[model samples]
Target chain A: MNAYPSKLVERAVEQLSTLPGIGRKTALRLALHLLSRPKLDTHTFAHALTEMRDGIIYCRQCHNISDTELCSICASPSRDTSTICVVQHVGDVLAIENTGQYRGVYHVLGGVISPIDGIGPEELLIDELIERVRSGTVKEVILALGTTMEGDTTNFFLYRRLQDFSIKVSVIARGIAIGDEIEYTDEVTLGRSILTRTDFDQSIRF
Target chain B: MNAYPSKLVERAVEQLSTLPGIGRKTALRLALHLLSRPKLDTHTFAHALTEMRDGIIYCRQCHNISDTELCSICASPSRDTSTICVVQHVGDVLAIENTGQYRGVYHVLGGVISPIDGIGPEELLIDELIERVRSGTVKEVILALGTTMEGDTTNFFLYRRLQDFSIKVSVIARGIAIGDEIEYTDEVTLGRSILTRTDFDQSIRF
Candidate 1:
C-alpha cells in the first residue's frame, strides 16, 4: 500500500482507481486535488453521480436512456415513425442525432449478442423491437452497427426475425471515411467499395 | 452541447469533465459506464468522495493530510526527530517513504512560492516550519523539492529565513536517473553529475 497519511484518502483513492484509465498514482493526484478544493465542488460532483444513477430511467419506447418515460427524440412529433434505426446503445442514437441528417427515430438493442460474453438475444431488447415492428407502423429497419463479427451476427439475426414482415432492411454504407487518402485506405474496405459502387450523382457537400 | 440522451447524463458529464485529464468524450463514457453498473457502485464512489472531502484534515505537526490532529509519522515513537524533510505535497512524502532509506519525519509545505501563480511564501506553511525549527528539537532540514524555478526560489527563501538558526540545511542530490543511458542524459544533469560525483567505495546495491 502507498503511504497515504489518511485512511479517508486511501478509501477515496481505492474507489477512484476503479474508473477506466485511472491508476493508483493518478487516483492519488485526483484525491488530493479534491481534498484541496472547496467542499461544494466535491459535494456537487458526488450528488451528480448519485442523483443521476438513482433518478435516471431507460426510455419505454426505444430503450435509449431517458429522464422520463420517453426520450425527447422518441417523443418529438417531427420524427418519422415509419423508419426505426437499430443501434447497440444510447450513445449511437446520440451520434446519429448529432448528424441531423436522419429524421427517423431509433431503437436501442442495449447490446449485441455475443456467445463468448454470455449475451443472447434474450438479454437484449430484441423482443420489444419485434413487438414494435409487429404493430405494422414501421416501413424500414436500418442496421447502423459496426462491421465487427458480433455486429454482423446481430444484424443477420434481426434480419431473420423481421423476415416475416414486409419491411425493408438496410445496412449502413461501408467505405473509406471522408477526407481519407486513397493510398492510405485499407485493402478490404477499398475492395468492398469498388465491388459495391453506388451512383456518383449525389450532390457534393461538406 | 453534445447530444446527451438525458439531462441527468448531461449534468453528470458536465461535473465529471471538471476533473484533470477528463474531457467531454471521456466524461460521457464514464457516465454511461456508471449507469450500466448496479446503483450500489456509483453510490459507493459518490460516498467515498463526499466522506473523504468532509472528514479529512491536515496534521497539526507536519501539515500532511490526516484524519487526526497528528499524522502517523509525527505520532510514531521510532521515527527520528533530529532531521526533518520538507516536501511540497503529501505525494512527495509517500515517494520518499517508499524508498525506506530515510527515517526522518516530513513537513509538507502545501506548495512552493511561485510568483507566476501568485503563490507567495506566506501562502505556504513556511512560518509553521520556522516555528518547528525554533522548538530546538530539529538539527537539520532537508529540502526534498522539484528542480523547478519555483522550487529553487522557495529553497533560497527558506535558506535566508533559517540563516539566523544554527542548523544544517541540505538539498537532495540531483543526478541521472537509474536505468538512464549516459549518452541520452541531458547536458545540465550530466554536467551536475560530473561536478558532484560521489566516492565509489560505497557498495553497489540493487
Candidate 2:
C-alpha cells in the first residue's frame, strides 16, 4: 500500500472507501480529484450529502424517499390510489417512474426477504403494506420485484397477506426483451415467452 | 432520465455527478447508498472532503501537498536535500516514495507543458525549480517524468534551463518491466533497452 504525502488525503480516502463499490484505489483517485477542484465544488459536494442525510424524509404511505411526508407520486392527486406497485428499493421506484408506463403509486419494501442475511418480512415494510391493503380502497396490488429467490419469497409472503382481501393481485410478466433474438435468448426466458405469448395483433400495433 | 421521488435526492445526484468519472446513473446509485447508510457515515464522508480541501497546505519548497510549511520528505534531515527528484504531481511524489528506492527530496511541477491544454512553462512551477537550483546547494536534479510527448517537451525545457548550472540533470531510465517478456515489448522500447543495456556482471549480482 502507498502512504499518502498528506494526512488530509489519507483521511479523505479512508472516508470515501466506505461507500459501497468504491475501493482504496478509487478512493485515492476521488480524493485527489477533489483536491484538484475548487473550494466551492468541495463545499457543494459536502453540503449536498449532509443536506440529503439530514433533511430527506420517507413517504408516510409508500415508504419511498421524499422531501415531504408523502412522495411526489403518492401525493399527486391524478395518480391512481387503487393500484399500488410494490418494489424492493427506492431506486426501483425511480426506475418505474422513468419508464412512464405505470400510472399507479409505489410501495418501497426496502429489501427482499433474505434469511441468510437475517432479513425477514418484519424487517421490511410488509406490515405497512398489509395495513395499506386493509384500508379497503386498494383494488389491485402489482408485484414489481427482482426474479431472485428472495424476491419470490417476499412476493409469496405478501400474496398470503393480501389473499384475504377482495382485490386483484398480479406479478409483472417475464419475457425476452423486445430487441432480443430468440436464438441467443436463455432457454427459460424463451420458453416462458412462448407460453405467455399474446394474440398476434395484441402483441403489436396493427 | 428518471425523476427522483425526492427533490433532495435529485439535488444530491446532481452534485455527485460533477465528480470525475461519475455519471448520472452512478451518481444516483451513490446518493441512494448514502441514503441507506447512517447519518454519521454521511457526516464523516462530507467532513473528510471539506476538511481535506480546506486544510491541506502545499509544501513551500517541494510544492507537494503537506500539513506543514515543508513536505515530510523535504523537512526530514536524513533525506538528501542536495539531490532533488523533479516530478509532475504530488501523487507522483507519493508513488516514488512508496517504492522505498529514492533517498532525495522532490520538486513537483504540478503538470507537464501541454500547449494544447493552454498550460505552458509559466503555468507550472518551472521558475520555482530554477530558483531552487540557483541556490547552489543542489548537486543533482533527476527528471522523473512520464514518457509521453508532453513529458518529453517539458523535460527538454527543464534541461535547457538547468544546463547553465553546474548540477547534474538526468532522466529516469525506461526499459521493459521486470516481469515482462522481450517478445511482447514494443519495438521502440525493445530497441532502447538494447541500446541502454549495462555490463552483464553489473546488471545482476552473482
Candidate 3:
C-alpha cells in the first residue's frame, strides 16, 4: 500500500475501510471526496454518524433501533400489538417495514444462531421474545428470518421455546419471487412452491 | 422511500448516501453496520473524518493534503525536487507512489481544466506551479494527468505557461499495458502505441 501523504487522510481511510463493504480503494475515494467538499458538509456528515451511534436507542419491547424507549411501530396505537415479526437484525426490520403490508411491530434478534460463528440464543434477543410472548399479550409470532442454516436453526430453537406458550407461530413464506420466471427458479424452491402453494386469491392479495 | 424507524437513522442514511458511489440502500447498510459495532468504533470513525476535514492542511509548495505547511514528499530532501510530476488530485499522487517507480516530488493541480464543469486554471493551483517553476529550481515538469479531453487541455495550457522558463516539459507515456494483449486493446491506445513506439533499450528498462 502507498503511504498517504497526510496522516489525517490515512486515518480517515483506515476508519472508513472498516465498514462492511468498503475496501481500501473505496475508503480512500470516500475520504478524498469528503475532503473536496465544504468543511461544513463533512462536519454534518460526521455529526450525523456520531449522533446516531451515541444517541440512538433500542426499543424496550421489540429491540428495534429507535430514538425513544419504544420504536415507532411499537409506540403507535394503530399497529397490532398482538402480532410480532421476529427478524435477525435491524436491517430486516426495516426491510419488512418497507413492504407496508405487515401492520405488526418487530422483534430484532440482533443475530441468528450460527454454530460455526459461535452465535447462539444467548447472543440474540430470544429470551426477551419469549418473555414478551409469555405476557399473554402476543397472539402470533412471525418468523421473518432468512432461509440460511443459521436462520433455520434459530427458527427451530425459537419454535421449541414458544411451544409451551398459547401464541401461534408462523414462518414467512419461501418460494420464487412474484415476477421470477419458473425456468430461472431454483429446483428446491420450485419444488417447495408447488408443494406449499397458497390459494390464488391469497397470493393475489399480497 | 420507506421512512426509517428512527430519525437519527434516517439522517445518517441521508448523509452517507451523499457520497459519490453510495446509494440509499448502501447507505442504510453502512449505517446499520456501524450501529451493529461498538459505539466507540463508530465514534473513532466519525472522529477520523471530522479531524481530517477540519485539521488537514494543504502543502504550501505543491497543494497536496498534509498535516503541516509542507507535505511529506515536498519536505523530504531525498526525493527529486528538480523534477515535478503534475497530477489532478492527491489520489493520483498515491497511485504513482504505489508503483514505486517515480522518485520525484509532485504538484497537485487540484483538478483538470474543464469548461463544462466550470473548472478552469483559476480554480486550480496553476499559479503556484508557475511561480515555483519561475524560481529556477525545477529542471523538468512531467504532465502526469489523465488521457481525457480535460487532461489534454490542462497539459497544453501548462505547456504554454511554462514556455518562457528554461525547463523541459514532458508527458507520461501512454501505451498498451504490459501483459495486455493487442487484441483486447482499444483502437486509440493501439494507434498511439504504434505512433509513439519507444527505443528498445528504454523499453527494456521499464
Candidate 4:
C-alpha cells in the first residue's frame, strides 16, 4: 500500500510544479495544504479566481481595469484634463496611483522602444499618444517612463513628435537608480521623486 | 511611476501581504509576477485555490474527496473491502494514494485524540469506524495513524474498541519516525511499512 491515497492530489502537485520556481516536493506540500482547507474556503477562493478571469477588462481609454469604455481616472471630473502621465505599462499606473497625490490621468505605452528586442516606436502606442497631444486638450505631457534604454529611446521619440506643440514636457525625478524598479521603491522615495521632477529641455527634442 | 499599472495588482499584493510568512515587498513581487501571466493562467491558479477551498467533499463512506456516497477507493470493485487502512487526517489518505499500491479503502479519523488540543474520540470519526467494523464485512484494520502521543492514544483506543470484533487488526510499520509525517516519508520506506505491517497484539479479537 502507498502512503497517500488520492491521484487527484498528485495531479494537482504536478500542475503546480509547472509554475516558476515551484518544485515537485514543494508543489506536493502546497497541494496537500490546500486540500486541508475547509470546503467553503476552497469554494470562495475558486470563485474569486473565476471572477478575476471573467470580470477584469482593460479600459479602452487608458488601458486599466474598468467596467466601462474609460478608466475611473479618465472619467473623473476632478483630475486635470490638460496633463497626462505616459508610462511604460499598466503596472506603473498603480504605483503612481498609490501615492494619491497625482491629479492627472495616465496613458500606457504598452511597452518601451527597444531596438535590440526589435520593439520600435511603431510597435508601441506612441502614435495614439501623439493623437492625444494633438487633440489640444492636453497642455502638459509627463514622461513617467522607466530607467532603461527603451525608456530613453521612447522619451526621445515622443519629445521629437511633441516639439511642435507648445505644451510642457517633463520627466519623473531621477533618484531611482539605473535598472531599478519604481514599483518596489518605498512610498517616501517615490513620492520625493514625484515632487522634485525635472523639465525636459526643448533643445533635446528630436 | 512603475513599469506596470494594474491597481488590482497592487490591491492583491496588499491582501497577500496579510497571509503568514508573506511580507509587503514579497507580496508585490508575487503579484506583479502573477499579473505578468496570461489572464487564463491567473484564472486557473485562482480556480485551483478555490477548488481546494470548496469543491472537495469528504466521502460519506470513506471520508475522502468524492462526488457520491462512497469514495473512489471504497466504491472500487478490485479493492480489498475487508481491509481498511486507518489514517489521522484526509491528507494522510492522499499520502497513501500516492504510492498507488494500496488496494484497500481508507477511514480518516479527522484528527488524533489530543488532550492539549481538547480533541477526544467523540470529536473524530472513530465511532463511525467502530460501527463499520461491527457490521462484520471488515476482516482487518490497519492503523496508519501518526507517531505522535495523540496518534498513539487514538490508535490504542481504536485497538481496544476493535478487540470486540472478530477480526485481525494491524498497525502500519514503525520505521516511520516518531515526529515524521507519513506524507513526507520516502515512497520506498512507506511501501515497506505497508508490506511488513505488524499485528496489533493489544487486541483480544486476534
Best by DockQ: 3
On a 0 to 1 TM-score scale, where does candidate 3 land against the true structure? 0.94
- Per-residue lDDT value at B169 in model 1: 97
Q: A72-173, model 3: which lDDT tens digit per residue?
A: 889899999999899988888878877878998889898899979888679889899998998878999999898998888899999999999888999999
- The reply for model 3, stretches above 4 Å from the true place, is A200-206
| DockQ, model 2, C-alpha based | 0.78
> Distance from true position, residue A158, model 3, in Å?
1.7
Q: CAPRI band of model 1?
A: medium
> Could you give candidate 4's fraction of true interface contacts?
0.27
Task: Please give the ranking of all candidate structures by lDDT, highest first, separated by commas.
Answer: 3, 1, 2, 4
List candidate 4 segments past 4 Å from native: A1-57, A76-83, A100-103, A113-123, A137-140, A145-160, A163-206, B1-60, B67-70, B75-83, B99-104, B114-119, B135-140, B146-152, B165-206
Order candidates by TM-score, high to low. Answer: 3, 1, 2, 4
C-alpha RMSD of each candidate structure in angstroms: 2.1, 2.3, 1.9, 9.4
Q: After superposition, how far is residue B179 of candidate 2 from its true place, in Å?
A: 3.8
For each candidate, the alpha-carbon lDDT, in order, equals 0.91, 0.91, 0.92, 0.73
Candidate 1 chain A: worst-modelled 10 consecutive residues by lDDT: A197-206
- Give Cα distance to truth, residue B178, candidate 3, Å: 2.9
Better of 3 and 4 by lDDT: 3
Off by over 4 Å in 2: A181-201, B181-199
Candidate 2 chain B has its poorest 10 consecutive residues by lDDT at B197-206
Q: Candidate 3, B170: how far from true, in Å?
A: 0.7
Candidate 3 residue pairs that clash:
none
Q: What is the lDDT of residue B25 in candidate 1?
A: 84
lDDT of 3 by residue, B55-165 (tens): 999999998899999888999978999999999998999999999999899999998999999997999999999999989789999999999999999999999999999
DockQ for every prediction shown = 0.74, 0.78, 0.80, 0.19
Q: Taking the tens digit of each residue's C-alpha lDDT, what string does model 1 give over B26-89?
A: 8888898898989999999999999999999889999888999999999999999889999998
